[model samples]
Target: MKLYTIDTGFFKLDGGAMFGVVPKSIWQRTNPADERNLCTWATRLLLIEDGKRLTLVDTGLGDKQDDKFFGHYFRHGDATLDNSLAQHGFHRDDITDVILTHLHFDHCGGAVIREGERLLPAFKNARFWSNEKHWNWALHPNPREKASFLKENILPIEESGQLAFLKEGDLFSPNVAMRYAYGHTESMMLPQISYKGKTILYMADLLPSVGHIPLPYVMSYDVRPLTTMEERQSYWQEIVDKEYILFLEHDPVHACCTLKQTDKGIRVAETFALENI
Candidate 1:
């Protein structure tokens, strides 16, 4: 099995919202914000090459939104989904699976693209994987999360007849298993991948960045912050015990890190790029 870090680029989000109740004095020390209090975050995706199957996990915000819509997020960076795939000697057509952690715009927007007046699946041959729970949540989004779950970014996969749901405890591949969490969104699937004699947990929004390792640093975007706290505590304990490498999706600086039990709680022990492993 081979893994590639597909960087779709960076966008900005309000630091205060990203950090939830954490004070700027605290979070700013790690994710320093710009003049507008927006911190740059990477919309990092993952590509898994295992013989016949090529799976792309989580497409970043695609370049389909209007300028007015994009101006709000301050999207900036050179990395693009197409170019990133090409760098790995692959193309969109080469992908066999699109495993979405959740259907938030930044996470799944690139799964579909606008061609003329029609919105369609970006990866023509890929089966888009999302859990049934998350699929329902995104389709009929609540008012708070409606903005993040754009219909244009979603619905297309189902319309294209390429959407598939992983049953609870289903194995996507031999080296990969799905773990579900609900703190960030309903039934967000975290891929636990065994590779190179190491376990890499794709830390979707469950742990957006290494800075969120301190337990209390939950995001305001989470539907249930308290649930997130509990989930993080349990997950971190296991991560520390087994020495799992966390593959971050939104961390602009760090790609991956392993946690160690600190006096306070679980904290990052060491950080490195995925390729270095």
Candidate 2:
């Protein structure tokens, strides 16, 4: 099995919201904030190539949203979904499967694109994977998360008949297994891939970055912050015990990191690019 790092670009999000109750003074040391108190984050994605099945984990914030809509997130950077795929000697259409970790715009926005007046699936030939429980949760979103779950980015997949629901125990591919984390959002699928004699767990929003390695650094965007803390506590220990490499999705500086049980607690032991593995 082969893996590729798919970098769509970077986006700015309010640092306070990103770090929840964690003080700016502490978080800023690692994720420094701008004058607007927004921190830069990468919409990094993972691409899996296992034989004929070419799967993309998550699509970054798409280009289809209007300027006014995008003004909030401040998406920037040169790496685009198409360009990144091209760099890997592949195309968007060549993708056979798109596993949406969740339906949040930053994670699934690029899954659909606007063509003329019609909104359609970006990868016309690929089957879009999302869990049934999360799909329903996104469809009927709460007041708190309504803004993040845009209909345009989501409804198109079901409309295109390319939407497929993954059950609890189903494997995305021979080397990829699906794990659910309800803390971030209901049934947010984390793809656990066994590659090169190492286990790489795709740390969706469950663990955004090395800065978030400390248990209290939960995101306010999470509907259930306490649940997030609990989930992180459990996952972090297992990750450290097994020497798992965490594939970070929103970390601006680090693509992957390993955790160590330090004197304080579990903290990032090392950070490196995916190619290093």
Candidate 3:
């Protein structure tokens, strides 16, 4: 099996909201904010190549939204979904599967593209994978999360007849398993992959960056902050005990990291590119 880091570029989010209850004084140390108090975050994705099946873990925000809509997020950077795929000698049409961690815009917006007046699946050849629980949650989004779950980003896969659901105990690939975390969003799926004699856990919104390693650094966007804390507490310990390499999606500087049981708590032990693994 082969793996590649797919960087779809960076966008800004309010640092205060990203850090939740954590003071800006602390989070700013790792993810420094701009004049607007918005922190730059990478919409980094993962590509799993196992034989003929080319699976893309998540698609970053696509270029379909209007300028007024995009003005809010301030999406910047040279990396793009198409350009990133081409760098790996692949294309969107080559993807056989697309594992959507959840239907949040930043995570799944690129799953569909706007052609003229029609919104359609971006990866026409791929089967978009999402869990049933999260699918329902995104469809009937709560007021707080409605903005993040854009109907244009979703619904198209189902409409295209390419949507698939991963059930509990189901293996996405020969070496990948689906794990669920509910705090960030309902039934957010994290893909656990066994590669090169190491285990890599894709850290979706559950753990955005190294700065969020500390127990209390949960995100305000999370519907259930307390549940997020509990989930992180458990996942961190296991990650440390088993020495799992975490594939960070939103961390701008670090693509992957390992956790160590330090005197302070489970903290980032090391950070490096996925290719180094």
Candidate 4:
């Protein structure tokens, strides 16, 4: 199986919110914010190729929102979903399965496109994958997360008759396994893919960047921050013990990294591109 890093550009989020209780004096060292206190983050997508099935894990924010709507996030950068796919000699139609980690706009906005007066599935030939719990959570979003789960970005997949759910033991492919985290959102699935003789865990908002490696660096956006801490603490040990390469989704600077157990705690050991493995 082959994996490709689909760079779908970058956007800005308030550094304080992203770091939760962590002080700016610390997080700013890794993810320095702009004058407005907004830090740049990449909506990095992953493409998995195993024979005829080309599964794309999380399409980044699409190019459908209006200027006024986009003014809030300040989306920038040249990388786009279509352009990134074309660079790999592929296209939207080439994707067979789209594994949405969760239905936040930045993660699933590109799953659907605005066509004329109607909303449509962006990947015409792909089956959009999301769990029932998260799908329902997004559909009837709570006040805190309502802004992130836009109806225009979701609902269209179910309306288009292309939505599918992955059960607890299901696999995206023969080499890929599924893991769930509830702190960030309800039943968020993290794809554990076996590739190049190593396991690459897609860190979809679970650990946004290396700055979040510490136990207390949780996000304020999470529904249950304490649950998030427990999940992270449980996973960090397995990640370090098994030596998993974390594929970060929002880390602007680093694409992949490994964790090492130090006296300080589980910290980033080494960093490199996916190809380096």
Instruction: Give per-residue CA lDDT, model 1, range 22-45, as digits (tens).
Output: 999999988999999999999999
lDDT of 3 by residue, 139-198 (tens): 999999999999999888899999999998999888999999989999999999999999
Residue 233, candidate 2: C-alpha displacement in angstroms: 0.7
- What digit string (tens of lDDT, one per residue) describes model 4 on residues 1-277? 8899999999999999999999999999999999999999999999999988999999988978999988999999999898999999999998999999999999999998988888899999999999998999999999999999999898789988999988888876789999999999999999999988889999998999988999899999999899999999999999999999999999998999999999999999998887788
Model 1, position 197, has a per-residue lDDT of 97
> Residue 28 lDDT in model 2?
96
* TM-scores for the candidates: 0.99, 0.99, 0.99, 0.98
lDDT of each: 0.93, 0.94, 0.94, 0.93
Per-residue lDDT of model 2, residues 146-210, tens digit only: 99999999999999999999999998777899988988889999999999999999999999888
Q: Provide the lDDT at 80 for model 1.
A: 94
Q: Write down the TM-score for model 4.
A: 0.98
lDDT, residue 220, model 1: 96
Error of 1 at 239 (Å): 0.3
Which residue pairs overlap in candidate 3's backbone?
Answer: none
The reply for model 2, stretches above 4 Å from the true place, is none
Evaluated against the true structure, the overall lDDT of model 1 is: 0.93
